[model samples]
Structure formats: structure tokens, C-alpha cells
Target: MIVGIDLGTTNSAVAIWRDGAASLIPNSLGDVLTPSAVSMTEDGTILVGVAARDRQSTHPALTATAFKRLMGAQKPVMLGRTRFSAEELSALVLRSLKADAEAYLGEPVESAVITVPAYFNDRQRKATRRAGELAGLRVERLLNEPTAAALAHGIHQREDKEPFLVFDLGGGTFDVSIVEIFDGIIEVRASAGDNRLGGEDFNDVMVELVRGQLKGVDALPLSNSELREIMRAAAERTRRGLTEADTAPFSLVWKGREIRRDVRADAFAEAAAGLIARLREPVLRSMRDSGIRTEQLSEVILVGGATRMPIVRRAVTRMFGRFPNASIDPDHAVAMGAAVQAGLKARDSALEEIRLTDVCPFTLGVDTVEFDRLGRMHSGVFCPIIERNTVIPASRVHVFSTVRDNQPVVEFGVYQGEARQVDANVKLGQLSIPVPPRPAGTVRIDCRFSYDVSGLLEVDLTIPETGASKQLVICDDADAPDDAAIAARREVLAALKVHPREDAANAATLARAERCYEAFLGERRDHIGQMIIGFEGVLQKQDPKQIKEARDEIERQLDALEGERFL
Candidate 1:
């Protein structure tokens, strides 16, 4: 059976089409949601999901999270003694989701449709697909997150044919889409986003607040993850609390003195003014690029958990002059919509007439030189062949000539972005075209960029005079790993041991206890230590029901202990 996976930055979920309807598949713990976290134990045991997340603070060296933001970057995530790329970390999350789906369905699942941010370029999209392949699943399709949300929204709304805007703010990325829904079709007109903006930024706003109020914070370098975790954990808890209350108080032991501060909801708003301003730009840009008036949009839909914030909602309202639709749960819409797409890929009878089309999120262009009035040449100018927001499965061609007289070779630099200068854009790759020793103006080559539905780019350079042509499937970011490198990394992953499925509950419980043991004082800390020992003894008895009951009781105690320690 094929499945739909939302390999999100902070959290992930899986769904499938069953009984002529889409359904979410529960993980081993019988929960529909899973944390996108992975941790490696000192003994070389690999732990994923909740078990891994539990160790993030106490076992920071062995733990890694939020690698999704580094998807196509050249930097590697250094965990303990090993270095891993963002895609490799993502593959671990995918592998866990795959296992959970198979366990629930009681069958082998080999294919999946994954979701990506609309603004992700060709390299980032390829990295996502490569991550899926590393997890042992053939990627059936790469669906845009906002587009998936539109599919889900279009089905529930009673509109026959209407245009709407989708405001998507996830943990690590934000995307906005202007789309039209009609005749069993969801056609996306334009999409825009910043890969680096999201809810996590708001959390950092809270962190900055605490840092300012607390003295001697700078004395402790963040290289100490333990110290950083304590600060961030308190910030995160208080930030989440602001969602429910006007003011939230956070207490933390600092410099041998207890520090207390009340963070107001409005303060977070002011600190994040720049970020909120960013949210406004894409809405206006999408509207302008699509040639759609704000009033013309039938409605505005909100997707992703970050949009649940009152501040974000208000920002959207002020920009579009409408209250965004909240009928869809911001968190679940993307995953659910992915399920619908999965069904479409299977050619499910239910969606026979529905067709979806998407647009390229950014401009594809190359560099050029032009002479000024004074006869001096400027070489940094960008000439776009395919403008941003062009519909996908698109082909565009432009002719470029050699640089100087009797130039032996002509170089074609492939780039993607909206910058007006060549150096300002992201260089995907370059191809050198040989033209038989001709004058600069005499030799010209046709450069065409073909973007497919999956968001991959294929470039073709054709020489008309000699009828010589060359094609390029641009390697991701110029430094992407080859097949041999991937194979070697796979072997390293295979060598590590994964905790047994049956033992996840125990591992999670122990990690939680240790986490609490770090935060509390005296009697409470000793009590948690005792509980861990007791739970370990109970697990050795090989009693499933007994272990579960003990685990639950201890978890409740741990939660209470942590609650009392925090604000």
C-alpha cells in the first residue's frame, strides 16, 4: 500500500487511503503524530520519535533535531563523533514513519508521496526525494505543502469554483499560495515563501527576552548545550503558555539565584515585528504576481500550526482585509491533503476528475553583459528566461552568445532566484559549450530550462550551426553526494542498532526521568532517580502489562515534577 507522509521540520505524520476514505496511521504508541527527532546512544543504538526527543536536553551530544532547515546546505550536522547531512537525518525520520505505517497496515509499504515547501528550489526538492529513497521508499510524487492543504480545503468548502489564498507557517518554513478551485481541480496560480522563517522564530523571541532580563547569561557560552537547553526549554514552555494566557511567568535557577520574569503576549508581538513584517510581503507579492486583487479572493485559508497564533492570524487579516478560514485544523491539513494526493496517485476511483497543477516558486535565469553609454561593459546583470511564478511542467529558451571575439568556449551558468545580479542568485550549476573558434557575435547557443511537475530542473544547450546539443540534470548545490557516498553512509546507518520496538515505552520513560532529574532539587530529584531504578527492575520481569502500568504511573509523576519546577 502507498502512503502519504508529511516529513515536517518539527513533527511528522503519515496517512493513507482506506475504505474509500483517507485515514491517519498511528505510530507504535497509537498516536497519529510523531516527532521528527533522532538520537544515537553511546552504545550505538538508534532511537527515533518520542524516545529520541525525550533525550534531546539531557543527551544533547547524542541527539539531533530540526535538521530539515539545513536540507541543501553545505554544512553537516555534527552529532557526537559522526557527521551527517540534513537528508541523512531526514531519512531516519522517514524510516521510522515507514516502519510505523507498515506495522499498522500489517503489510509491506513500498511507495509514498512526500510534501515539500512551495519555495524550495530544485536542489532542496531533490534532497527531499533522496531522503525518501534512503529510507527504502520510492517517492511517488513531491507534493507542495500548501497545495496539499488546498486539496483538503477545497473538498470541505462548499465552493463550486472560487479563488483563495493559503497562508502556511510551519516550524521552519513559511509559504503562501494564491490558487483557484474549480471543476474538481485545484490550480495553484503563484507561490512564495522564505525557507528560514516559521514558528521557531517566535520561540527565539522569547529566548531573547529571557536572555536580556537574566544577568550573567553571556558568561556561559552556548557551546554548553546543557546550559542552552535549560534556557531554551524554559523559553519554549513560557512561549507556549502565552498562547493561552495574556502573560506567562518563567522561573529558572541562574547564577545561584532564582530568576523570575513575566513575559506578556504583546511583548512577543513587538519583538517579532520584523518577522511579522516578512509575513506581509509574500501575501502582497503573491497577489501582485498572480494579478489577483485582494478583494477578488473568495476567502483566505490558514494552514500549519504556526498560523494558530493570534498574532499571525491578525497579521493575515490586516494584509488581506479578511479573517482567515480556520475550519481546517492548521496542523493536520497538510498530512491529510497528502493522503488525498496519494489516493490520486493510486488512481482511486473517488478522485477521477480532480486534477492539480502547480507553479514554479522562483525565477530561472542566467547572467549577461551589457555596454553602457560610455562604452564600458557591465557583467553582473541577470537576464531571466523564465520568470518567477510560472506554471510547472514548463519549458523556456533563451539564446546566449560567447563573451569575446574568437572565444573558444561559451559558458552557461544556471541560476535560480529573483535577484537582479548573477552573484546574488543561487548558482545551480554551469555548462561549458564549445563553439568552433567563432567570433563572439557569430556564435550563439540556445539555453532552455525545463521544470517538471516534481520541481526538478533539466537544462538543454543546443548549437544550431553545428547541430550539437548537450543536456544537464543539475547536481544539487554543486557539492551533492554521489551514489558511492550515499551507499557508504547507508552502511554506517545499518551498522548502528535500533532499540527494539517493544522497548520504546521503557526507553522513553527512562529518558524522561533523567530529564526531570536534571531540573529539580534534593528530594524531588532523588525520587525521580528511584523511580527509574524501579521501572528498570519491573521491565526485566518481562511483563508487558505490568511494565505499561508502571511506565504510566512514573510518567505522570515525572510530568508533575517538571510542571512544579517550571513556571
Candidate 2:
């Protein structure tokens, strides 16, 4: 059976279509959400999800998070002795989610539909499909996150037929889209987003606040990694608390100096004020490009866990001059909608009547040379044939002529972006074809582009002069590893033993104590240090009964010293 997976930046989840409805499958921990964190322990063990996240504060150098922002980039993330691309880190998360889905369904799942930010470029989307393949699952479809959210919310709505908007602000990415539904048909009008903008930015703001204060008195006495993890843990706690309470205090100790500050809603809003401003531009652009008026939108729906923050809600309301609908859980909407899409792909009886359509989030064009009447030529100009937000499963063709007399070949550099210059756009791929030498502007070539709903792009070039043609399926081949390389990576991952599933609770407890021990000093630090050693010894015994007994005591001691985790 096919399943739906939401491989997100900060978290991941899995779902399946069952009993005529979409059902979210819980992970081994009996939770619907799993942190999208991966880490290598000091003993050369790889941990994913909860264990990895818990260890992040203690092992910052060997842990990687938020790599989703680097998707399609050339940079490599250095974690310990290895360098990994963004897709490789993402594949680990996907593999973990696949394991969870299989365990819950009691079956071996081989295919899935994964969701991505609506505004992801061609390279990012293709990389996501590659990540799924590396995880041993065939990606059936690449559904846009905002479009998936709409499907989840509008799936059972038989009475409401008005148009709405989906504002998705997750942990590491943001996407805004306008949606219209009529007669069991859902259509996405337009989309816009910032790949690097999200709730994590707010967390960074809190971290900066601490850094600024530390610089005021003296230079940091601790290592950069130590300071970073401490600030991340504290800031995240304060950020999550501020969602429900008006004030959350941030406190930490360094070199006998106590840093204490209360982060109130007003102060946080002031600190995160810039992020709020950035959110407006995308929404306004999406509406303007979609030719939609503010009054035409019957409702504005907020999707993504980041939307739960009051500041985000207030920002949305201020922009639209109306309150947004929060009936659907922002955290689970995307994954749930993915399940619906999975059902649609399978042609399930319940979803047989629902017809959904999406648009291309970017314009596809070729690098062309434009010659002026004065005999001046301008190169690197982007000639768009298919505009952004055009209905998918669509094709467009543009005819071009050679720039110079007897030009031997035509080099086509295909790009996907809004920039007017090819240099500013992302080049998905390129193809060069040899053309019979002809006089300038005499030979014509048909540049046809076809875009499908799955976010894959195909470019076809045909020369009417000689009936010769060339085509390029836009995909990033350089970033994709061969089957042998993929197998090698998998073997390495499989070798780095993940903490046993049954011992997750004990493993988490030990990690938390280690983090606490590193952050404290004086007698409190010594007490936690001994507690950690004791737990480690117990874990080495491999006796589940003994480990549980020791874990309860260790957790109690750490809780007493650390107070509440999110305080």
C-alpha cells in the first residue's frame, strides 16, 4: 500500500488512507510528530528523531538540523568525520519515517507521496524525489505543501464553496498560496515563499539577544559550540512558552555569571518584528500575482506549527484585516492532505470524485540572445515561455532564431525562476544541439516546455530547418548518487547502530542528563555528572529491567536540577 510522508525540516510524519478517511500513523513513541534531527553519538552510533534531538544540545558538532534550507545548494554539511549534502541528511529522516510507517501498518511499504514547500525550485523538488529513492521508496508524487494543506481542510467541506488562502510557516520554510474550490475541484491560484524564513528565525533572534548581552560585559568564556547549544535549548524553550503565555524567562549560567531575562510577548514581538514584516511581502505578492482582491478571499487559513505563535496570528490578521481560520491543526494538515493525495493517486472509491489541480510555482525559460536594430546583441536574457502559476499539465512553445550567421550550435540553458536575467535564476539543466550552419536569424528552433503537476519539467528543442531535435528532462544529475554509491551510503548508515527502539526512553533520559551536566557547575554539576555515569553503566548492561529502574531515578534527579524542560 502507498503511504504519504511529510519529511519536514524540524519534524516529520507519516499517514495512510484507511476506512475512507486519512489517518495519521504514530511513530514508535506513540506520537504523531517526530523531530527531523540526525546525530552521531560519541561511540559512532547514528540516532534519528527524538533521540537525535535530545542529543543535539549535548553533541552540537556531530548533529545536523535545519539542513532543509540548504536543499539544492552545493555546500556540504560537515558532521564529525563526514561531509553530507542536504539530500543525504534528508534521506535519513525519510528512512526513519518509512520505518515507522511500516511498523504501524504491519506491511512493507515501497511507495509514497511526499510534500514540499510550494515555491521550491525545480532542483529542490527533484532532489526531494531523489531523497525518497535513496530511502528505498519510489516517490509517486511531489505535492506542494500549501496545496496539500488545502486538500486536508477542504476534503469534507460540502457546504463551504468560497475561495481561501493558505499561509504556511513551518520550522524552516515558509509558503503562501491562494486556493479556490468549486464543484469538488480544488485549484491553486498562486504561490510565494522564502526558503530561509520560518519559526527558527525567531529562535535565532533569542539567541542573538543572549550573544549581545554576553558581549556587553566580557568575551565568551566557553567554546562556540557550547554557547550555541545552550542558547538554542534556552531560546527554543522560551519561544514555545511565549506561544501560550505572555512572558517566558530565559536563564543560563556561564563562568559563575547568571544570565536572567524575561522574554515577554511585547518584547518578543519587538525582536521578531522584522520577520513579521517579511511575511507581508510574500502574501501581498501572491494575491497580486493571482489577480485576487482582498475582499474576494472568503477565509485565510493558517497552516504549519509556526502559525500557532500569537505574533504570527496577529501578523496575519493585521495584513488581511480579518481573522484566519484555525480549525485545522497547523502541524498535521500537510501530512493529512498528503494522505488524501495518496488516496487520489490510488483512485480510492471515496476520493474518486475529488478532482484537484495545482500550478507551476515558477516560470520556465531559456537563456537567449536579443539583438537590437542597431546591431547590438544582449546575451543572458531570460526568455520566459511558461509563466509562473500557470495551470499544471500544460505546455508552451517559443520560437527562436540564431544570433549570428552560420552559428554552428545552439546552447540552451534552461532555468526556473522569476529573475529577468539568466544569471539570477536557477539553471535546472542545459542542452547543446548542433545545427546546420545558417545565416543569422534564418534558422528557427522550437523550444517547447511541458510542466506536470508532479513538479517535474521537460524541455524539448526542435529545429524546423533540418528536422533535428533534442530534449532535456530537467534534473540535477550531479547531486544524485549512482545506485552503487547509494548502496554504500546506506550500508554506512545501517552500520551506525541506532539506539535500540525499546531503549529509547532510557537513551533520551541519559542524553538529557548529559546536557544538564554540561550546562551546570558547582555541586549541582557534580551530582548530575555522577548520575549520567551511572545511567551509562546501566545501559551497557543491556538489561531492560535494570535500565528502566535506573532511568526513572536519573530522570527524577535531572528534573529536580533542571526544573521544567520548557521553562
Candidate 3:
């Protein structure tokens, strides 16, 4: 069976092509959305999805969520007795989803079309594919998340004659794509986004607000664990509230006092001003690169949960001079698109025969040496192989020669990104073209870069004169640690007495949470003076056991307090 998976940062969902239609497979909880969280049990078993997320309030450290942000990062995180590289952690999540799909279909599932953010660079894209392999599944193709959403939209409106933009703001990333559909073909003219921005930032802002309210009181002593649980729950509530209400109220009792604060819609908007502003450049750049003006785009399709905020909707409308099309649920559209792609892959659907053309989000180049006036070799010259916005499933070639006499090898260090300076871009990897012992500029090495629909790049280096060559599958970087090293690292990580399962980790995570809360309190001391007075009253019961219980109760109140802005 072939399936489509949206392995989101905060949550994930899987869909399959069946009965000539796309269907989503719900997790054990009967919910389509599964939190991208993982929890390890005392027996070394791993629990994924909603179960892991449910444990987060109690076991914050053991439960790893939002690891997607760390994709391509050189660092690995230690969890419990197990240390997991970013790819392994992602595999755990994907494996869980695959299990759910297989059970639903009563058949073994093999290949899949996974969706990724449109702006993911080569390293990140490669990491995603590796994750799929680690999960024991073959990735048929890597579809851009926004492109999938566009496919779903286009399928729904096969008769509509208008160009649309897909604005996807997921849990940990945001991407805006401009797509045009004509004669059953979906062409992505341009795409852009910030991998670091998403719904998590909004929650962090609310968490800070609540921390300030507690800090205003001069007499309250709050534990870090207590503050974090309160803030996390509060941030979640605030995020939900902003979806509908004009004002949301958050109230909590710390020590023996009652604390309350109402976060108005306007305040929520103000808090997210910086994040919202960041979206402008990407949207404008996508449009500008596509050569499509606001007037030319017939509709804007919002995809992802973050777009549910009225503030976001209004900002998009103001920018495009038209309200976005919200007929399709933002959260489900990407998965639906993924399913559609699966159907196409399976060749089992009658949906209009459509071909999608995507582009590399970043530039592809090589690092070369240049001579200075002093005749020193400087190695920062970047010769681009494929420029950004070029059609995908495309390849480009560049020719270079050895600068020194009798140089037996020409080393080409490949890079990705639009930055002119080598330090400003991602050094993907390198390929060395072996040449015969020849004098300066005597050998011609042809370097070719081929990018597929999955956004994976492959480089082929050929010594055309001698017919000697070397090829590299871009996703397979030879220098990256192999499975053995990664496994050894994981074993070492597991033995570090990492924080315990859900509830135990929660305590330590709460401490970190409290530090963040206190920092917020110090910054916003003036606005929450009254709330602080009440917050301290509840914290005076200092018995450890009682404090723990009271802290949980108080955190619930904070959750309610932050829930006001959207609901």
C-alpha cells in the first residue's frame, strides 16, 4: 500500500489512496492529528503520538517534540538512557504513523509520498529522506507541503479558473507558495518561508505574559516546575482562544492569592506583530520571483493551523487585497494533498491527470579557488550550478580546471543557498574529480547537478577528456556518521540517567519553564503588579509534596488564563 504522510513538527498525520479516493488513518485515539512526541518507558519501549504528548505535562524532558526544527543540525539530543540523532527521533514518529496505516489497511505498506516544507534546503531535505529510511519505509517521493495543499485545492476546484497562493504556517515552520493551475497542470512559480517561525512562538509569548503576572508580587516563591506547567498549559489555551474570542482571560492562584489577567485580541495581535511582520518578506519575494502581482493572484489558500488566527487572515488579506479561501480545513489540506499524490503514484485514481513542477528553494553551487594579487589561493569563489527558481527534475553543468601543475585531483566543494559568501550558505558536501597529472588549466572537469521532484540533489563529476567520472547521490553525504556511529551514540545517550518518563521529566522541565517565566516577570514587572500579589498567596504552602500538587492545580488555572485571547 502507498500512503502520504505529513510529518509535521508539532503533529503528524497519514493518509492512503484507497477505493479511488484519499482517506486519512486516525491514530489510536481516533484523532487524525497525532502529536509528534515520543516517550520512553522504564522497560525501554517507546510510545509515540498522542500518548507521548499527553505525558509531556508530567514528563517534559523525556518526551521529545518539535525535533523537526533540529533537522540537519550537527547536534544530537540525549533522551533518557537513549541518545537520538534528529533523524532517529523523526524515524520513531514516522514508524508509529506507518504502524497505524498498516493496521488500518490490513496490509503491509512499503512506499510513501512524504510532504516537506517548501523552503527546506538540501541538507534538511536529505535528513527527511534518511528519516523515512530509518523508519523502515521506502520514500517514493518527497512532495512539498504547500504543493500538496495546492493539489488538493486544484482537485477540489477542477473547473475554477484562477491562480492561488498557498500560505502554510505549520507548528514549527512557515511557507508561502504561489501556484498556477492550467489544463490539469500545477506549476509552482515560487516558494519561500522561515523554518524557525510557527505556532510555538505564539505560545511562548503567552507563557511569558503569565510569568510576568506571577512575578509582580514581591512575596511569592514559585518553583520552576510549577511555572513551566502553568505556562505551557496557558500558552496552549491562549493559542486556541485567539481563534475566535476578542479577549481571553487567564487566572491562577499562587500561594493563597487569586491572580487573573485578560489577554485581549488586540494584545494577542501585538504580541505576534514581529512574527507576522516576518511573513511579509517571504510572501512578497515569492510573488516577485513568480512575477505575479497581488492583482494577478485570484485567491490565497491558507494551509496549516497557525493561519486560523484572525490576525493572520487579516494580514494576508491586507497584503493580497483579498480574503483567502478557507473552504478547506488548513490542517487537513496538506495531508489530503499527500493522499492525492499517493493516488497518482499508485496510478489508481481518475482525478484529472495533473503534473506538478517544483523548484529548488535554494541556490546550488561549488566552492572554487581564486588567485589574489599576491598570488595566494583563496577558496571562496562560488560558481553556481543551478540558480534558484529554476524548474525541478532539472540539471545544470559547470566546468572548471585545476589551477596547479601536476595536480592529480580537482576537489569541488558543493554548496546550497543564495548567499554569495561561503560562510553564509550550507556546505552540502564535496566531490573530487580525479584527473591525470597535467599542467595548470590542462584538464576540464564537468560538474553537473540534478534535482528531482523530491528536492534531492545528485552531483556527477566527469573528466570529459579522459571519460573518468564520479557521481554522488546528494542525499547520501559520505562524511555524515553512519548507522553504527549513530547507534553507538544513541546507546551512550541512553545511559546518561536522562530525566525519567513523563511526570518526572515534567518536574525538571518545569524548572526550566519557571526560569523562563521569571525572566518574563522581570521584563514585564509593571503590568502585572496586582496579579502578582494574589499569585504569591498560593505559593506560601512550601511543603514539597503539597507544593507539587498545588503547582499542578495552579498550572491548570494558568492554562485557563491564557485560553482567553482566541476563544
What is each predicted model's overall lDDT from 0 to 1?
Answer: 0.82, 0.84, 0.75
User: Which residue pairs in candidate 1 have backbone atoms (N, alpha carbon, C) closer than 3 angstroms, thus clashing?
Assistant: none
- Model 2: per-residue Cα lDDT over 1-567, one tens digit each: 899988888888899988899989987667788888888887877777777787777778898988888887789987789787888888888888888888888999899999999988877887788788878888899899999999998885644566789999999999998998887889898998988888789898877765666656654544578567777778888888888899998876665666777787898898889999999888888988899999999999999988989999998998889999999888899999999999998899988778889988888899988878998989999999899889888999999888888999999998888898999998878888888898888999999999878665788999987899998885434446787987887776666667666666666677677777767778998898888888889889989889888988887777787775431
Runs of candidate 1 with Cα error greater than 4 angstroms are 216-223, 253-259, 436-440, 474-485, 559-567
Give candidate 1's error at residue 152 in angstroms. Answer: 1.9
Per-candidate clashes, comma-separated: 0, 0, 27
Query: What TM-score against the true fold does each predicted structure earn?
Result: 0.92, 0.92, 0.80
Models, CA RMSD each: 2.9, 2.6, 8.2
For model 1, residues 253-322, the per-residue Cα lDDT tens digits are: 5444445689888988888889999988787789889999988999999998788787888888888777
> How much lDDT does candidate 2 score?
0.84
Ranking by lDDT: 2, 1, 3
Scored by lDDT, model 3 comes in at 0.75
Q: Give the TM-score of candidate 2.
A: 0.92
